[model samples]
Target: MTQTWLITGASSGLGTALALAALRAGHKVLATARNPTKAAQENPQIEELGGIWISLDVTSPDTAKHVTDAITTAGGTIDVVVNNAGYSLLGSIEDMSENEIETQFSTNVYGPVRILKGILPFMRAQRSGTVVNISSSAGVDGAPSCAMYAGSKFAVEGMSESLSKELQPFGIRVILVEPGYFRTKFFAAFVAPAAGLTEDYVGTPVEAALKAIKAKDGSQEGDPVKAAQRILEVVTSRGLGAGTEGFLRVPLGQDCYNRFQTKIDTLQANLTKMKEIAHSTGFDS
Candidate 1:
């Protein structure tokens, strides 16, 4: 069955890769970017493969309306919506300015919220759809110099979890894709603190993390093409995702798997250790 997919931030990275993958799989793609002209210029294959580029800036207050308009223009039915437009703001908590943090959340967190508000009505009425939110490994485990970025992704994870349950009865599926260090312009595009690294962070983990990130910019282990293909397969229940239904989260890359495992282990350990203490908070019934 051919489905229509609406993908944000399709100008580059995993968004562009997913658009191409879906197009090759015979699906109609509504690829959106902040600048469709430039996006088209950068990714001519999308147009060649029958993908339509729509202009959408997720950070804008009118994002929900724009999404609704785009859906209406695309024949009023959307099967898959990928909220993939986001960028990282890398810095220490104190180093980041208020505007920087707000911008990060606006793009990474609120962007998806607006998209959901626009598409939920249609999906509910249709009683079928998939919402794929692209999170990050940092979302599962925080790291130095990534407080703001991790916070944004954590918000995504939390919302997606609740949304999955909320939409289950409506036959709508929500998936959070937590990818780790994919070989995209993601690393290269990260914004640093506007105030620059303060002397307090000169020799701290923040500096080390920044250096490590720079070193890994173009040498990330994960492949965006393969990741995109996997996402498509998961949504359509083909390839590796065959027979895998009722899965809420898809953690991409070995790094992501490792991080998730670590988090699970830590949580289990804490639960066991604090069982009595946790129970003590409740009053006798």
Candidate 2:
């Protein structure tokens, strides 16, 4: 079946990879970037591969409406929407400035929410669609020096979980993709440092973790191409492992899978430990 896939941040990295993969899989791709002209100049393969490149800044208030209008004007409905645009702020939470924190949330959290709000009406009308929110392993488990980034991703995950339920009746599927460290520019030139540095926390775990992350930037093991292919496989119901339909969250990479299991185990243990107390608090009816 031919599908129309709308992907954000398609200028590079996983976004580009996914766009190309979708194209190769016989799906129409609407690839968006902050600057379409610049993105095209940088990566002409997207256009060459039949992807329609559009200008889109996720942080812009007009972006969602513009995208919705464009699709409507073109007489098209998006079958799959991929929210893949985001960046990380590597530093202590205390070291982050107000603007930096808000920026992270604005791009990583609010941006996707706005996009979904704009697109849901169309999906509801059609009564079938899929939304894939690109999160991170940090969303499942916070890491040192990544409090703000992880918080933003966690927000996405929580929202996606509720949305999956809300849209289920309408036949719209919501998927949260939690990817571990991948061979992408996310950890290279794209990752930003804390704008406001706190001297008091110079020798803390946050500082050490930031240094380690910088050192390990380009050496990540996960391949973006493979990840993109796997996403397409799941979205298309080809059944690569568990189908995307029954799962709300898809943890990519072995590292992410391991961490996800660990988190599940920890949650189960905590629940057992607090079960009696929690049940007692329900009240003495």
Task: Report the Cα RMSD per candidate.
Answer: 1.0, 1.7
Clashing residue pairs found in predicted model 1? none
Q: Candidate 2's residue-wise lDDT over 1-285, tens digit each?
A: 889888999999999999999998888898989889999998888888888988788898887798898678656688999999999887877667788888898999999987887788889999999999999999999988888999999999899999999999999998888899899988876455546458876788887887888888889999999999888887877858354579887889998999989999999999999998888876568
Q: Model 1: per-residue lDDT, tens digit, 1-285? A: 999999999999999999999999999999999899999999999999999999998999998899899899999999999999999999878988898899999999999999998999999999999999999999889999999999999999999999999999999999889999899999999999888988989899999999999999999999999999999989999999887678988999998899889999999999999999988997789
Error of 2 at 16 (Å): 0.4
At residue 170, candidate 2 shows an lDDT of 97
After superposing all C-alphas onto the true structure, candidate 1 shows an RMSD in angstroms of 1.0
Residue 164 alpha-carbon offset, candidate 1, angstroms: 0.3
Runs in model 1 with CA error above 4 Å? none
What is the C-alpha local distance difference test score of candidate 1?
0.94
Provide TM-scores for the models.
0.98, 0.94
List of clashing residue pairs for candidate 2: none
Off by over 4 Å in 2: 190-196, 239-244, 282-285
Cα lDDT listed for each candidate? 0.94, 0.87
